[model samples]
Target chain A: MKVVALAGGVGGAKMADGLARVLPAEDLTIIVNTGDDFNHFGLRICPDLDTVCYTLAGLANSLTGWGRSEETWNALDSIRRLGGPDWFQLGDKDLGTHLERTRRLSQGEPLSKIVRDFSHSWGIAPLVLPMSDQPVETWVETQEMGWLPFQEYFVAQQCQPRVKKFAFKGVEQSLPAPGVLDALEQADCLVICPSNPWVSIAPILNVPGIKESCEGICVRVAVSPIVGGKAIKGPAAKMYEELGIAPSVLAVAESYRGLIDGLVIDAVDNSCRDELEAMGIHVLVTKTVMQDYIDRMNLAKETLEFCQKLMLYKGRQ
Target chain B: MKVVALAGGVGGAKMADGLARVLPAEDLTIIVNTGDDFNHFGLRICPDLDTVCYTLAGLANSLTGWGRSEETWNALDSIRRLGGPDWFQLGDKDLGTHLERTRRLSQGEPLSKIVRDFSHSWGIAPLVLPMSDQPVETWVETQEMGWLPFQEYFVAQQCQPRVKKFAFKGVEQSLPAPGVLDALEQADCLVICPSNPWVSIAPILNVPGIKESCEGICVRVAVSPIVGGKAIKGPAAKMYEELGIAPSVLAVAESYRGLIDGLVIDAVDNSCRDELEAMGIHVLVTKTVMQDYIDRMNLAKETLEFCQKLMLYKGRQ
Candidate 1:
């Protein structure tokens, strides 16, 4: 089946990678969040786009799930010595992406085209598209700091400030990238990968036509980022708690309530399956924690099968 | 005696390093050429200023006469991998200087202050100053290409293009940086380091009020970059030849005829001493080729002694 996966950073990249393993290169199109994109040291840096690209290319550091494997920090070490920003660690190999991307951007090339070119250069077969060609910066409102750029809150401050809300600046003006609408239109399934609902998927969905395009798809399924009341990665669970909501599979399902027809929750949260079913959402309880490559592939396989079941249920109705 | 040495890239940096070794930190100030500075990959790169700073900080690659010692090419290699401009090789450590300098410049900091801060951070004792806080880019008019930026001509084109002339863009409005005029006014002598007269020393002199300040000084001596009808390093000799002037000690002397009171030439060109004297300029014949640290120190000492003799001769006259 033709699959379109919406992804964020590491967690999303992991899920995207899993989907890539099951789907044909031409059949899978992974749309990556670009809300975390920021300019650092005068170079344009796209965290989620790079993560998805690296993971798909099999160049990601397996241990960290971000950055390149066997990456060198010589540039970062030198930057630190010169008293440049050391909070966001830019490895030598990864810096190539930012440097080239920035150069191209300055030369008037769009981010999507640059990402496309980079993916081709890295021998990536599956299509990886940034959510928008235009910038849509994610700004986080925190209790301590009024409004912090997503990276400043996430990376520089280590996500310490209590979460309030997120604003995807420029999202209203941004159109989904060139192939995004077409991918959604042609896809049999639209899978929202296990990424933060607020920062990651929200920014992508908030783009003008992206959500409406996904709504038109036959089967729309979402993999829960939260399992057993905690996020598998990043500050999603903490953000949920701070926002006065209990972090759970039901909360994740509710976050995507009307848009998604099926929800893929972890085995640990199976008790919520019946409750989710009662709310008219199909629930699939499976192992969602991707501890290894096999785990990623298995979760991906189950998610795809669940999408097929959702399609059958829709036909029966 | 308080001394100010005017310098450019590798050769000039060598002379500056020699002066730094012999003169106390408070007694010496090295004013470097900023004409060769350019923006590459969105980073402000000051070739001559960085060379002088690296040499003084003892971080320069002695063999290559530029860049950091034992530097890794990770950044350049990565840039190359991404098909970015790799013609201008930026080592990982060297990129640190460029990145920080660019950041500070973008933040509206003056180039001179940034250089001063970087020098202090590197533990460089002697003051290292760029000729101007304002940019004065050297554009070379060549037979092959009409006008190429200094780095494009020197590094990218490998100086293959026949020299026509050079224009110091913005030199007319550019003022000598802070402390430069004061250093000249209070200086006992001004030593024009053995750097390219046309591209390096000329740019500094071209700065408004700088050449006039040097003219007001009693003792002004220049060490000849040309020896045995050829430049010891770089394209100075070729430039002289291309400009229809014989690349010799006599030609070098004539280039600075009225501006300098004394000239330091290599021992091989001692035959031109009488001719230089006839032009109302004192000539000192010595070993000007600096192959090692001791050679640099000895050349610096001879250049200083030549200035002292010129001072004595002026007193006698």
Candidate 2:
């Protein structure tokens, strides 16, 4: 069965990794958010895409859930001492991606082509696509800074930007890249890979024509990033609470009401299953903590079975 | 006694180093060639300027006459693994300059300010300014590549191209940076360091208003990059031969004939004193080979004394 997953950084990468492990390489297509891409020291840093790419290539630092394992920071430290902004951490080995990507982009190569070529170089098999070809930066509308780039708000500010809301700059101008529509069109299922609802998935859905494409054919499903008012990683839980949401699965379901067919939450948050089901959304509760390879595969198996059974029930009816 | 020294790379850096040791920090201003600057791995690299800066900071590699003394190439090797072009040999420590300069430039800081900041950061007190504010890339019109950027032609292509001529792209648009004119105007003596006559000094002179600003000012002099029909360091002699020059001090002198007031040669090439004198140029013969600290200081003393003699002669006339 063909499957398309939209993802952001570490947490989404982990889920994407789970899907890649469970499904055939030909069946899985991952669409990464490129909103964090920015030129720093002339290097084009694509944080989310790199997280997914490295995770798939087994090059990611599993402990940190970002950058390459065994990476050095000699370059970064030297750069810092030279008085460049050291807020956003770039590992030395990981810097190769930014360097090559920046160079290629400066030479008129598109981000899509660079990512595809880089994925090929890294020996990643599954199809990986950027959400949009044009710039669609996720800007945080903070009370202090007024508007901060997603990384500056999320990373540099350490998510301390009392975020009132988010603004996806250039989203109106962005279009879903070529393979994204095709991937959704051909897929048996569209999975929003447990990424941040407002920032990650919203940016993907914000792309013009993408929502229509996802709504047309695919059995769209979402794995809830929130379980028991907690995120698996990153600032999602804090962001949800700061945005006046209770940081719960029900809040996530509300956030993605029209977009998803099934909502996958952890067994720990099983109490909210009926509440979500009451809202006419199919709910699947399982061990969603991807602590090990087995956890990923098991969760992937359960989700696939849930989608398969739901489709079968609909077919019979 | 303010001084402005025009320089290229290694040989220029050596002379600049000698002068830097002898002169007061604020008195000596070294204007280095940015013609050798190139974008590698998305970072702006100023090769000639970096060589001068590192040498003056006492951080220069003794063997290579360029780059940082204690250096590591782990980043370059890592970049190679990531399938990047590591051909230009970017060391970890040297990356500090590129990163800082790039960061500052991206923030709309001028190259002159960045160079001064970099010099101060590295504990080099004397001023070092790029020859121009705007980029004036040196392109070698080669028989093979037609025209290649200076670094590509020099480092990547290994200078294999049959030299036709040179082009200083964007030179017409370039302006001599802030301190350049003032340094030239206020100087008691001007020393043209033993950098490449064609590639280095030519680029400096090619800057708009720089040549006119320095002409007929104080005691303008140059040290020999060529002695016994050979360059002390780098491809000056080879480049001279390829460009159809005889690779002698006379050819070197002829290149700078209109721009300089006096010439300095080693005692070894003293036989050609009459030839240089025939051109109506004052010549100084000295032990120019800077084998150690004493040799460098002695050469600096000779250059200074030569400048004094030129001023005295001019007074007599």
Candidate 3:
């Protein structure tokens, strides 16, 4: 089946990698969130886009789940010694990507074009697209501080500030990046990778026509980022708690309600499956946590099968 | 005696380093050429300023006469792999300097301020200043190519293109950087380091009041970059030949003309002493080729003593 995946960083990258393993190059398109993209040291840094690209290219550091494997911090260390910002860790190899991207962006090339060129250079088969070519900044409103830019909150502050709400600057004006609508139109299913609902996937979905396009798809499956009351990674669960929602599979399903027809929950959250079905959403409970490459593939296989079942069920009805 | 040094890159840096060894930090000020500065990978790279700073800080790679010692090339290597520009070599440590400098420049900080802060971090005690706070790009007019930016000619084109002339884009509008005039005013002498007169020292002198300020100083001595009819390093000799001047101590003396009171030439050019003296310029012949630290120090010592003698001679007259 033709699949278009929406992804953020780490968890999303793992899920996207799984889908790439199962599908042919021509059949998969991964739309990465650019809301987290920011300029550091005068270079454009796309955290989620790089994570997805590097993970699929097998150049990602497995330990950090970000940056390149076997990376050095000579540049960052030097910046620190020079008294420049050292809060955000930028590895030398990863800096190569940022420097090139920033150079191209400053030359007036679009973000999507840069990502396509980088993916080709990286030997990545699956087509990777940033959510939009235009600049979209994700700003977080925190109780401690009035409002913090996404990276300042996520990386520098280590997510210590309680998030009041999240805002995607420029999202209202941004059109879906080229091929985004077409990919959604051609896809049999849309997989929302296990990324944060508020920041990662929200920014992509809120991009003008993306949500409406996804709504037209026959089957839309969302893998829960939260499992057993905590996020598998990042501050997704904490963000949920701060936003006044109990972090759970039900909350994840409700957040993506109306758009996603099927919810993929972890075995630990199977108790919520009956309630999800009662609320008119198809449910699939499996080992949703991806510990390794094998786990990613298995979860991907089951998710696609679930999508197939949901498609058939919708057609019969 | 308080000394002010005019410098550019490799040869200039070596001379500056030698001076730094002999003079106390409070007594020496090095004004570096910023004409070769350019933006690469979105970072402002001040080649001449960085070379002088790194050399003084003891962080310079002695063999290459540029960049940091024991540096890694992960960032540049990665940029190459990504099909980005890799013509100019930027070491990881060097990139940190560019990145921070670029960041500060974007935030409206002056180039001199950034250099001062960097020098402090590098433990360099001598004051380092760029020729101007405003950019003064050195563009080369070549026979092969009509016009190229200084770095495009020097680094990217490897200085192979036959020299026609040079144009400093903003030199007409740029004022001498803060402290430049003051350094000249209070100086016992001004030592023009053995750097390219065309690109390096020329750019500094062209900064409106700089050359005029130097003229007011009693002792103005220039070390000849040309030795044995060849440049000690870089494209100085080729440039002189291209400009229809035979590369020799006589050519070097005439290039400075009335601006320099004395000329320091290599021992091989001792025969030209009478000719230089006839032009009303005192001459000093010494082992001017600095192959090591001791040579640099020896050369610096002799040059300073030569300046002292010229000062004493002027006092007697």
Candidate 4:
């Protein structure tokens, strides 16, 4: 089946990688969130786009799930020695992406075009598209820090600030990048990978026409980022708790509510399936924590199969 | 005596390092050529300023006479892998300097202030300053390439292009950086380090009032970059030949003309001393090719002593 996956960073990149593994190159397109994109040390840095690209190209550090495998930090270490900011943890190999991207961007090339060219250079088969050509920064409103830019909240502050809400600046004006609408139109199913609902998927969905396009798809399934009352990674669960909502599979499903035709929950959250089905959403309980390449592939396989079942069920209805 | 040195890249930096070794930190100030500075892969790279700073800080690669001593090439290597330009050969540690400088420049910090802060951070004792806070890019007019930026001519093309002339784009309008004029005003003598006359020392002198300010000083001595009719390092001799002048101490002396009171030439070119003296300029023959720390110190000492003798002669005259 033709699949288009919406992704953020690590978890989303893992899910996208899983789909890339199982599907033909021509049949898969991954739309990555660019809301987390920021300029670090005067270089354009797109965290989620790079993560998805690196993961798909098989260059990602398996242990960290971000940055390149065997990456060096001579540049960052040197910057630190010179008393420059070192909070971002830029890797030498990963910095190449930012440097080249910044150069091209300054030369007036769009981010999407740079990502496309880089993917081709890295020998990546699957198409990786950023959510928008225009920037949409994710600003987080926190209890102590007020409003912090995404990277400061996520990386520098280590996500310790109590979350209030997220504002995706520029999302209202951002159009889906070239091929994004076409990919959604051609896809048999849209997979919302297990990324943070607020910062990651929200920014992509909030783009002017993206949600409407996804709504037109026959099958739309979301893999829960939260499992067993905590995020498999990142601050997704903590963000949920701070925003006055219980962090659970049901909360995740409810967040996607009318847009998603099916929800893929972890086995640990299987108890919420009956309630989710009662609310008119089809539910699939499976192992959602992707520990390795094999786990990613298996979960991807199950998610796609669930999409097929949901599409058939909708047709019968 | 308080000494101010005009410098460019390797040769100049070596001379500055030698001066730094012998003089107390408070006694020396090095004004570096920023004409060779350019934006590489979106980073503001200052070749001469960095070379002087690195040499003074004891971080320069002794073998290459540029870059960090224990530099890593992961960033540049990775950029090459992605089909990005590798012509500039930016080392990882070197990139940190560019990155931070670029960041600070973007934040509206003056280049001189940033250099001062960086010099202090690197434990460099002597004051290091760029010729101008405003950019003064050296564009080389070549027979083959028409016009190429300084680094493009020097590093990227390996200086093979036949030089016709040079244009310091902003030099006519640029003022000497904050401390540059004050440094010259306070100096007992100004020593033009053994760097390229066309691109290096000329650019610094071209900064509107800099040469005029030096004219007010009692002693102004320049060390010839040529020895045995060849440059000790870099494209100085080749450039002199291309510009229709035989590469010799006499040609170098003529290039400086009335601006300098004395010329320090290599012992191999002592034959030209009388001819240079005929032009009303005193000449000192010494071992001007600095190969190591001792060579740099000895050359610096000789250049300063030559200035003292010229000052004494001027007093008697």
Candidate 5:
């Protein structure tokens, strides 16, 4: 079955990794959020894209869940000594990706094409597309830094900024990246990876017709990042609370109610399934946390099964 | 006495290291060529400036005669696997300098200021100036890659390109960086380090008024890179030969005849010293090839002594 998975970094990459292993390369198309993409040291860096690529290539630093494995940080050290921006840790090897991508981008290659070339280099056979080819940066309007780029807010400021609101710069003029709307349109099932909804998946949804594509035909299911009032990984639950939303699996379902058809939560969040179903949403309770590679595969398999069941029920209607 | 040195990479860096060790930081200023500086993987890489900094900071790789000491290849290896431009040897730690330099330059910081910052970061108290603040790329019109950049010729093609001509792009609009003229005007002597005259030192002269500064007030002396008929390091001799110029010290002196007041040659080229002097150039016949630290310091000292004597003669005049 043709499956389209929406993702960001870290949590999304892990789930994408699981899906890539479980499904045939040709069947899986990963649509990554480009909001985290920013320029550092004059090199274009797509943190989410790189994390997804590295994880798939088995070159990711298992410890950090970001950057390359066996990475040495002499470059960051030198930048720190030079009093340059050392807040964001760009590993020497990891810097190569940004450098090459920036070079290619300067040469007039589109972001999607640049990503395809890098993915091919890393032996990633699955189609990985950015949510938007146009430059769209995630800006966190914070009390401390006023409005800081996502990375500066997240990595540099250690996420300490009291986020007032989030802004997607360039989203107004941005078009859903080539193949994004098509991927959603043609997919037998659409799965949202266990990534942050507001910061990660929101950016993708905001890309004009991308959300519109999922509204009618596709059996869209979101894997809850929040289980038992806590995020599986990252600051999703905290961000939800900061935005004044209840940090729960049901909250995750409520946010995606218009675009999505179903929600999959951890067995620990099985109690919230009734509340979600009461809102006319299909709910599935599974072990949502992917602790290991096998767990990821199992979760992905279960997600696909849930989506297939949801689609079958929709066909009967 | 205040001294200014024209330097390139490796050999020149070694000499600069010795000179910096002997002379107090304030007494020495190194004017490095920027013709070899190019954007690699979108990072502005200044090879000559880096070599000088690494050598001065005692962070130079002893085995390679360049790059950072105790460097890791993880970044390079990953870059290669990612199909990055791996022909140019950029150590993991060394990448930081390029990244920050490019970052600063793109942010509207001048090359001179970036060099000063890098020098300061490495604890190099001596002034290190790029030949010019403007971008001057050395384009080698060659048999292989016609009009390839300097690094493309030297590193990528391994200097195998049959020379047609050397062109420095943007030389006309460029000005010698700040403090460069100050160093030249105030210095007691100037020693042209044993660098390629045509490629390395010529770019500095191409900067408007820089050559004129070296011409009038400074007691300009040159250490010949061409020993007998070959260079101590690099393809200077080969390049000279390919460019239809003889690879002798006399030919080298002839190249810089109008610029130099005196030429320092090896003991083996003592017979040719008279011929060089006959061409209206004062010649110092000494062992100009620096085999070790002692040799580098000794030659620097000898060059200073010759410049001191020339200044005394100037006083008499």
Candidate 6:
């Protein structure tokens, strides 16, 4: 089945990798969030896009779930010694991507085109598209810091500030990248990978035409980022708590309420099944914690199977 | 005695390092050529200034005569793998300097200020300064190509193209960086290091007020880069030959005919001493090929003594 996936960073990359392993090259397309993209050391750095690309190519550091494997920090060390900004950890091999991407971008090449070339270089088969070719900076409205760029709030500040709101700065004017809408329009299934709802998938959905196109898909499913009342990674749970919502699978479902037809929750959150069903959302409570490659593949298989079942039941209705 | 040295890259850095070892921090300032500075991968790279600083700080790669010791090439290797411009080798540690310098420059910090800070961070005692804070890009007009940026000719093209002419694009409008003229005006002696005279030392002389300031110094001397009719390193000899001048000590003396009182030539080119003397220029023939630290120090000492003798003779006159 042709599938389109929306992804953020580590958790999203893991799920996308699982999908790529299960589906044929032409059967899967990953639309990555570009809102977290920022310039560091004067080089354009797209955190989520690089994470997704590195995961798909098997070049990602499994330990960190980001950056490249066998990475060297000589550059970062030198920068630190020079008293330059050392807040952002840019690995030596990872810096190669930023240098080339920035070089190409400055020369007027689109972000999508550079990503496409990078995908080809990494021997990736599945098409990976950025959410938009234009810039969409993610800003966080915090109680302590007021308004800060997403990276400063996330990496630099370590997400200490209480979350008040999230803003995708240029989302109002951004169009879906070249192949994004086409993939959504033609897909049999649309999967929102287990990523942060506020900062990750929300930015992708905010891009014009993407959410509407996704709604036209036969089966739209969202895998909950929060499992067992905590986020698998990142500050999703803390953000939820700071925003005055108890972090749970139900909160995840409610966040994507009108966009998804079904919710895939972890077996630990099975108690929410009845509540979710009452709210007119199909519930799939399965083993959703992807700790290893096999776990990822198994969860991906179950999720695709659930989508197929939803498609069959919808056809009967 | 206060001294100011003009330098370019590897050869110049070696002489500057020798002088730094001999003189106290307050006694010497080295003015480095910035004509070859260019934006590569969107980062400002000052080759000569970096070479001089690295050499003096004991961080330079001894084998290559440039870059940092024990440098890692992971970034450049990855860039090559991605089919980006790999002609200029940027060691991971070297990239940190470029990145930080670019960041500070974009933030309105003068190149001189950044170099001063870098020198301090590197534990370099003597002052190191660029020729100008303003952009002074060296462009080479060649037989094969009309005109190419200095790095494109030197690093990318490997300096194979026949040299026709050299142009410092912004030199006419550029001012000497802070402290350059002050250092020259206060100097008891000025030593032009054995760098490419055409592209290296010439760019410094071309900067407004620098040449005049050097002329006011009590003693001024230059070490010949050409030894036995060939440049020690780089395309100096090739440029001289292409420009219709035989590369020799006499040619070197004539090149600095009016500006210098003495010329330091390698022992192999001592045959031209009489000719240089005939032209009213004092000649100091010595073992000027610096193979190691000892050689560099010896040459530096000999050059300084020669300058002192000239100064005493001028005082007598």
Query: Which candidate do you rate higher for TM-score, 5 or 6?
Result: 6
Best by TM-score: 6
Model 4 chain A lowest lDDT segment of ten: A95-104
lDDT-best of 5 and 6: 6
- CA-lDDT, candidates in order: 0.91, 0.85, 0.94, 0.91, 0.86, 0.94
Clashing pairs in 1: none
Residue B299 of model 2 has an lDDT of: 86
Instruction: Kindly list the per-residue Cα lDDT of model 3 for residues A84-169, writing each as its tens digit.
Output: 99999889998889999998998999888889999999999999999899889999999998899999999899999999998999
For residues A27-75, write the lDDT of model 4, one tens digit per residue: 9999999999998888889999999999999999999999999999988
- Model 1, range A244-300, lDDT digits (tens) per residue? 999998899889989999999999998898899998899998999998889989999
Stretches > 4 Å off in candidate 1: none
Task: Judging by DockQ, tell me the better candidate of 3 and 6.
Answer: 6
The collision pairs in model 4 are none
Q: Model 4, B1-317: lDDT tens per residue?
A: 88999999999999999888888889999999999999888789998999999999999999999899998898887788878898987998898889999999999999999999999999999999999999999999999999998888888899999999999998889989999999999998888888999999999999998998888878888888899999978999999889999999888889888878888888899889889989988888888888888998898777777777877888898
Q: Write the per-residue lDDT of candidate 5 for residues A33-97, one digit (tens) a residue.
A: 99998877778889999999999888899888889898778889988888988878888788777
For every model shown, what is its TM-score relative to the native structure?
A: 0.98, 0.91, 0.98, 0.97, 0.95, 0.99
Worst 10 contiguous positions by lDDT, candidate 2 chain B? B73-82
Cα lDDT for residue A300, model 1? 95
Ten consecutive residues with minimal summed lDDT in candidate 6 chain A? A283-292
lDDT of 2 at B247: 92
Q: How well is each residue in A1-317 modelled by candidate 2, as lDDT tens digits?
A: 88888899887898888888889899999999888777667777888999999999999998998998988776777777667778878776777677777777878877888788888888888999999878888898987889998888878888887789888899898888878898888988888888888888888888988888888754778899987789988788898888887899999999988888789999889999899999888988988778877877787788888888778866787
lDDT of 5 by residue, B58-136 (tens): 8888878789899886667767876767888878788888888887888898999888877777889889999899889
Docking class of 1: medium
Give the runs in model 5 whose Cα sits over 4 Å from its true position. Answer: A143-145, B143-146, B312-317
